[model samples]
Target: MQPDVPTASCCGEADAYFADEIHVRDGKTYAIITDDRPDEPRGRPHVDIGTEIEVPDHKLKWDKGNPTGHGIIFLSRNRYVFCYVQPGGA
Candidate 1:
């Protein structure tokens, strides 16, 4: 069975993107993976594997992974987090 893919109310917004579908497994939700953004800076630093990244905890569904105590884990640059109020989104 497929996970419930929520609709992103923020569409056509500037400097932002949204996922069309997502998958939930082991109580953790994940979206389709991506690498880098079109507007990404040329020399922007890349986040390494296992490094803790900040994510909206309120939108997170689980708690057991990182410093935030929110189970939202960003294990790769391709891991796009699914949050309730996306940054720069409407």
Candidate 2:
């Protein structure tokens, strides 16, 4: 989905999240990734398009209690990637 909503997370208020492809529409699967860490500031985090990453299973937490079943992918002690799973999804 193309999320035009601005979020406090990610790059703060400077830019809105979901400007790039996050999850494929064909399936529920999404690529786990880390910040690309550019040599210079780009105002927002960047991820390599085809670079899929792997983290501990425990880090991927799914919140079934939420209406959207939103989950959090904890990448590090202070970094995390929020997964917004749409309703009616597995």
Candidate 3:
């Protein structure tokens, strides 16, 4: 139910930033949305969205976000995708 809320306002290592490792059609179920990272807009500019990434054992769970962990994947160009990953405790 909460996933329906837009993530445009969420950035940095925040929980309300993203959802769990739930899959959805980019152009269908829910549109992939993005917003400038106010704290670090140019953070990791090399990475893009939709890129697959392996999680580091220590870097699994993020600071927030349901304690479900999150990871970043590269996208088309200078964009980074924020998504869920297997929780470290899992």
- Show model 1 residue runs off by greater than 4 Å: 1-15, 33-37, 40-57, 60-90
TM-score of every model?
A: 0.28, 0.30, 0.26
Number of the candidate with higher lDDT, 2 or 3: 2
Per-residue lDDT tens digits for candidate 1, residues 1-90, read 001234432112232233323456666544432323443453323443333334434444332222322122222235344342222221
lDDT of candidate model 3 versus the reference: 0.31
Clashing pairs in 3: 15-65, 48-74, 48-75, 49-74, 49-75
lDDT per model, in order?
0.33, 0.32, 0.31
Stretch of 10 with least lDDT, candidate 2: 11-20
Sort by TM-score, best first: 2, 1, 3
* Model 3 CA deviation exceeding 4 Å by range: 1-40, 66-90
Instruction: Highest TM-score: give the candidate number.
Output: 2
lDDT of each residue in 1-90, candidate 2, tens digit only: 212223423223212122122354444445433333351353544444344433323322233322333222322223344333222244
Ranking by lDDT: 1, 2, 3
Looking at candidate 3, the ten consecutive residues that score lowest on lDDT are 27-36
TM-score of 2: 0.30
